[model samples]
Target chain A: MSDKPESLTQADESALMQLREEIDRLDTEILALISKRANCAMKVAEVKMKASGNAGAVFYRPEREAQVLTSVMDRNPGPLGNEDMAKLFREIMSACLALEKPMEVAYLGPEGTFTQQAALKHFGQWVKTKPMPAIDEVFREVEAGACNYGVVPVENSSEGIVNHTLDTFITSNIKICGEVELRIHHHLLAGPNTKHDKISRIYSHQQSLAQCRKWLDAHMPHAERIAVSSNAEAAKRVQGEWNSAAIAGELAASLYDLEIVESKIEDSPDNSTRFLIIGTEQVGPSSEDKTSLVVSMRNEPGALYHLLKPFNEFGVDMTRLETRPSMTGNWTYVFFIDFAGHCEDESAIKVINAIRETAVDVKVLGSYPKGVL
Target chain B: MSDKPESLTQADESALMQLREEIDRLDTEILALISKRANCAMKVAEVKMKASGNAGAVFYRPEREAQVLTSVMDRNPGPLGNEDMAKLFREIMSACLALEKPMEVAYLGPEGTFTQQAALKHFGQWVKTKPMPAIDEVFREVEAGACNYGVVPVENSSEGIVNHTLDTFITSNIKICGEVELRIHHHLLAGPNTKHDKISRIYSHQQSLAQCRKWLDAHMPHAERIAVSSNAEAAKRVQGEWNSAAIAGELAASLYDLEIVESKIEDSPDNSTRFLIIGTEQVGPSSEDKTSLVVSMRNEPGALYHLLKPFNEFGVDMTRLETRPSMTGNWTYVFFIDFAGHCEDESAIKVINAIRETAVDVKVLGSYPKGVL
Candidate 1:
C-alpha cells in the first residue's frame, strides 16, 4: 500500500499515515506480547530449577532452545522470516532466563575472547562475568563459588581440542554441566597510528596467529610474529604502535582502541570453537539429550576398537570421539565420547556398563540436555 | 636450556646463541615433519574421496587435529602451558591443509560480512571467492558452477535457522555436503574523523543490529537504527560521513578505513552463526560424521512420537530434530533430523524406511559424513 507512486495525493497520504499508525499500534502490541513471553520464560526457568534441584539449571540448554525456537519459527508468519522471528524470541528468552536467576560466569581473561563469547551465548546477559588470567583460574573461581559457572575452550573446528580444557577435566571435580560451540573469526587489528609500510610485527594469542597462518604467509611474510596469552592481551600491547598489529576478535579491537588492518584473517573462514561449561551440578533430562564419558584404555592396538564395539553392537550412536593422552601412563589414552540418549535410558545404561567392564576407568562427564543452537 | 638461570658460571652469551641455533634446527626438522604429515593428509583425502565419492575431501579435520595437538601438549614439559602448545599445533595443521587444497566458495557480499568470514573458514585460501547480492544468487552461482561450493547461513546456535536458507533448500536440489558453525562478533565502526558525540545514526544489517540488542539498549538507546542489506554495505555507506557510524565486522572497518568506536557489541559474547556447504554431490564419511534428513508427519496429536518411535525402537540416535511448516498442507509440519550414522548403514536405512511408512513423506536430504570440527 505504501508503494503507490502518486506525488503525495491528499487521500493517499492520509491513508498511508493511517496504515503506518496501525502498524505502530500492532508493533506496540507485539512488544507487549514479547514481554509477556519473556515473563513466562522466567516461570519456566523457576519450574525447571525446582524440578532439577539445581539453582543454576535455568541457563544453557542448547538442544532445548533449538527445539523451542524451531517450533516458534515454524508457526511464525508475515514480513518477518523464521530466522528473524526466532532471533527476536531468542533475545526474549535470554532476557527471561536472566530474570529467573542471574548467574555469574568466569572465563580466561581479558575480554572479547572466543571463550568469553561462548559463556555469553550459553548464559546470556543475565550472568555477571569475571575474566580470569588463566583457565585454571576459571576453574578455581567456579570451584570456590566465586562464579556460578566457568567456561573454557575445549576445541576449535579448525584447531581441534583445547588440550588445557581436557587436561583440566581429568583432574578437576567440576562437572561438565553444559557445552557451547562458537565459530572463531580472527582479525588483524592495528592502532590508528599504524602505517601499512611501517608494519614489521604481529602479535596475538598463539592460536589466533596460527589460525591465520596462510594469510600471514601471503600478505605479511616479512613481519615478525609474537605470541601472547590471549587475543585481547595482544590487542592491548599493539595499541598506539605503528609497526605492529594484533590478530584478535572485533571485541579486542574496540577494547584496546585498535583499528582493523584486516578482518576474518583466519586461515579458514568456517573456523569455530567449542567450549565446556563447568559447574557443580548435572543437567536434568529434557525431551532430547546427550551424554559424555571419558574411558581409559590400555596401550594396545585393538583397545580402541574393543571399546567402540559395544556401542555399535548395541546400536547406540556416538556423536564425538577423541583420545587424550593419559597422564598416569605412557602411551595410554583416555577416549572422550559423546553419544545420543540420556544416561537414564536403558540402552544408554547398558552401553555404559559394557564399556566400563572393558575399560580400565570410565568417567561419566555428566548427562545434560543438549543445546538447541 | 633456555630457562636455565645465569647462576651457572658456564652460561655465556655464545652458549645461548648455540642453544638458540639448536632449537632453530629442531624447529626446521619439525617443520619438515609437519610438511610430510600434511602431504599424507592429501593421500588420506584421496582415499576418503574414493570411498565417499566427493572430490573436495582433503581439508582440516578438527577432531583428529585436536587429538594430535592434545597429545603434543600432554607430552610437553612446558616452558609453555598446554594451551599455548596445542594452539601452535592447530595453526600448523591449518597451514598444512591450506597446502593440500585451496578452496574457493561464495557467500552473500560484500567483504567484511560474517557470511564472508564463514566462507573463509570452510574453504580456507585454497579456493577463489565470489560474492553474490542475495541468498538466491549464492545458490545460483553454485548451481551455475561459477564456484565449487557455496556457504550460506543455515542457523545460529542462539537464534535458530535462517529461514531464507531453509526456503532455498526447499526449492533447490543442492545437497548440504558439510556444515560450519561460526561465532559472530559485531562492532560499532566509524571513520577516524567522526566524533562520537556527533554520531546521529547507526547503520548495520538488521540481523547484526538485533544481535547487539542489549548493548544498543544500554548505550545508544535513542540513536536511530537503520537496516541495510549487509554489513559491508553499511560500512560502504559510512565512508565520508562524520555523523554516521556503522555496526559491522572488522573487515568492513578495514575495507572502508573506518575506526571501531565500539567492538564486541553483540549482547552475548558467544554469538555464533552456523553455515551449510552446498554442492552438487553428497559428502563422504569422515572418521567423525553427522547425517541430516527431513521427514514429514501427519497432523495428529501424537504424530511426532509415532514418527520418532522408529529411531527409539531401532536404537538410532537423533542429534537434532527441528520442525518446519509444510507448504503442501495447513497445520502440517516437516521435521528435520540430524543423526549419528550415514544413511547407508543398515539400521539407518531401516529407520528411514520405517519413518517413511509412518509419515506421509520422507525426504532423505543427504547422508554425508559428519564434520571433524
Candidate 2:
C-alpha cells in the first residue's frame, strides 16, 4: 500500500514537471512570434512612409488594431478574458512602434510632469526625450534640429486651454505634427525617513494642490500648503523630512528616492490633458487628418462674423479656435483655428484665400495626419 | 507741493477703485452673456435630443467650439492674447454645460484616487459624485440606479489596459455612456507633526508604485514599499502614524490632514489615463458618433476572416477590436469592437448583420455620440 502511494506521488510530480516544461516552451515560442510580428510592423511603417513621402510617419492604424484584438479574442480559449488578450496586443503594438523609430521628443518639463507623459504616449519608449523649461523652449528644440518633435499641453479637459502653448504656436515656425490625449492623475508622496505624526508642511505645484481643494478642505483643514516651482522640485525638497511631503507623480518618487505614501489621489478620475506635437517636417497623408491655421483680423465689430462665413459656405469643419494678442499692433488679435481637411486640398486653399481677404494676417500652421490613439 | 502730492495719490487711488469697478461690471456682463449662451445651448441640446430620440445626448460640437474660439480671438482688443481669450471661452462653455445638466457620477474609491480626478474633468464641479468600493461596484451602482453613470479606468498610456473594468463589461448590461481622459500625478504626503528623517515606510496602491518603479529604484532605494487598497486608505493610515507617509493625490493631503512632502512624482510627465462612463442609458447622434458591439464565434478556422470581410467590403470603418474568452463554452471566444458611424446608418447595419451571420452571438453595446474635445 505504501509503495503504491509513493508511485502515485511520483507520477503527479512528473506530470507537474512536464506541464512546466510545456509552458516554458510555449513562452519561448510566443516571444519569438512577438519579435517577428514587431519586425513586420516596422516593415509596414516603411511602406507607409514611402507611399506618403514622409520617412517617419506613424503607420499603425487604431482601426486595424481593433480588428486584430477582436480576432485574438475570438480565438482565445480560457480563464483570460477578451480584454486581457486585447491589452496584451496594445502593449505589443506600443513596443513595436518604439522599435520602428527611436523618436527624439522635447516637452515642457523639469521631468515627471504631465507633458512628459504625453510625449511618451504619443512617441512611445522608442523615442529619446529632452526636457525643456518652458513651452517656447519645446518649440525651439523642435525648430532648431535638437529634436524630431516637441510635445506641449494645448488643453486640459477640466481646466481648459493651455494659453502658453497656443501663444507659442502663434509665433513659432514649428508645425502641428500630431496630437496625443492623456488622462491626468495626481498623487501625494513623501520621503522614507519621515514620521507621519510630526508633519507640519506640505509642498506641491499650485495647480496640483488646487485640483484637490475639495478633498483638502474635508481632511486636512489645518496643514499649511506651500507652492513650489514644479512637482519634481517639491519631491526633491521632501528628501529628508518626516513631517513634510509633496504632491507629485511617480517620477518624483523614483527620482527623489522617496516612497509613495498614497496613490491615484486625484479628486476626479476623468481628468485628461491634450497635447500637440510640434515639428518642422510635415506628416504624410493619413486616412484621417486634421489641419490647423491662424487667421488675424483687424479689430472691428463684424470682422469675426465675416471671417467665419467662409467656413460655413465652404462646409469646412473646424476643431479648435484660439486667440493671441497681435504682437505688432495694440488692441488687435490673431485667431488660431484648427479644422478638419488638409491645406493641400482645393476647398481648404479656397477658404484660406477668402478669409485672407477679410483678415489682416493669415498663416497656415501646418496640416498633418491626426493621431488615432 | 504737499497738496499736489496728496492729490496725485488720491487720484491714483480713485483710478484704481474705478478700474476695479469697471472690471467688476465687465465680469457681470460676461456672466450674463455666459448664462444666455448656456440657455441657448440647452435649447440646442433639446433639439438634438428630440431629433435623435435620446434624452442625454451631447449636442456640443467640437468644430463649432473651434470656430467660436477663432471668432473671439479675431475680434479681441487686447492685452489678453488669442490663446487666453479662447481659454476663457472654453471654461465658459464648460460652465455652460454644467448649467444645462449637472452630471451625476460614480468612481471606484474611498476617495483621493486617480479616477476621481478624471471624473472631475468630465463633469466639472457642478456634478454630483459618489464613490464605490470596486470597479464592478461602480458598474453595478450605475446599472441599479444608485448613480446616473460610473467612471472606470479603461487603459493607461504606460501600463496598458485596465483588465478589471474591461472584463466586467463583457458580462454587464451597462453601456459606455462617455469617456474622460486624465494625466496622472503622484505625491508624497505626511501628517503635520512627523519629522522627515524619522519616516521609515511608504504606502500606496500597487499600480501607482509600479508606474513609479524607475523613480523609486533611483531615489528611495532603502525604504520599504507598501501597497494598500487606495491612496485614500494610505492617507487615512498615515494620520495615526508619524513614521509613515502616503503616496496619493492632493485630496489626500486635505483628507487625512497630511502635508505634501513631494509633488508630480509620476515616471512620465505625460502619464494620462482614459476612463469610460458606464450607464444603462444609450447615447444619441451628433455631428460625429462611434458605435461599440460584441460578437462571439465558435472554434472554427476562418471565422474571424469572414467576420471582418464585411467591414472591408461594405466600407465600414472600425476603430477598435478586443477579444475575451467565452465563459460558457470551452475553446470559444468573444470579440468587442468599436467603429465609426451609428448602428442606424445603412452601411453599418449591413456590416453588422454580415458579422452576425458568422458569429454565434452578436450584441450591440451601444452607439454613442463621439466626444468633440
Name the best candidate (by TM-score): 1
* Residue-wise C-alpha lDDT for candidate 2, range A1-373, written one tens digit per residue: 1112122345444553454354334333333344445445555555445544664354433324433445555654422334433344444455556555555789876444677767766654335676665789888888887787788888864345777787777777887877778876666777777776555777888877887666666666677898887777888888867789887766556557676676667787766778988887555444456888888788999988878888888888977777777887885788889889878777888889899898888888877656544
Q: What range of 10 consecutive residues in model 1 chain B has the weakest lDDT sum?
A: B1-10
Q: Give lDDT tens digits, candidate 2, residues B1-373.
A: 1112122345444553454344334323333333345455555445445544655454333334444445555654443344434444444455555555555688876444567757655554335676665799999898887787788888764346777787787788997766667776778888889887777888888877777777777767666889887777888999999898878776557546687787777787877788877777565544456788888899799978887899999998989888878788987788888899877788998998998788898887776555433
Worst 10 residues of 2 chain A by lDDT: A1-10
Per-model TM-score versus the true fold: 0.44, 0.40
**Second chain TM-score per prediction?**
0.67, 0.65
The candidate 2 chain B region of ten consecutive residues with least summed lDDT is B1-10
Off by over 4 Å in 1: A1-12, A31-66, A78-83, A144-146, A156-160, A189-247, A250-259, B1-373
lDDT score for residue A58 of model 2: 46
- The Cα error of candidate 1 at residue B364, in Å, is 63
TM-score of 2: 0.40
Q: Ten residues in a row with the worst lDDT in model 1 chain A?
A: A1-10
Misplaced by over 4 Å in model 2 are A1-102, A108-113, A132-134, A156-162, A188-210, A220-263, A312-317, A340-351, A368-371, B1-373
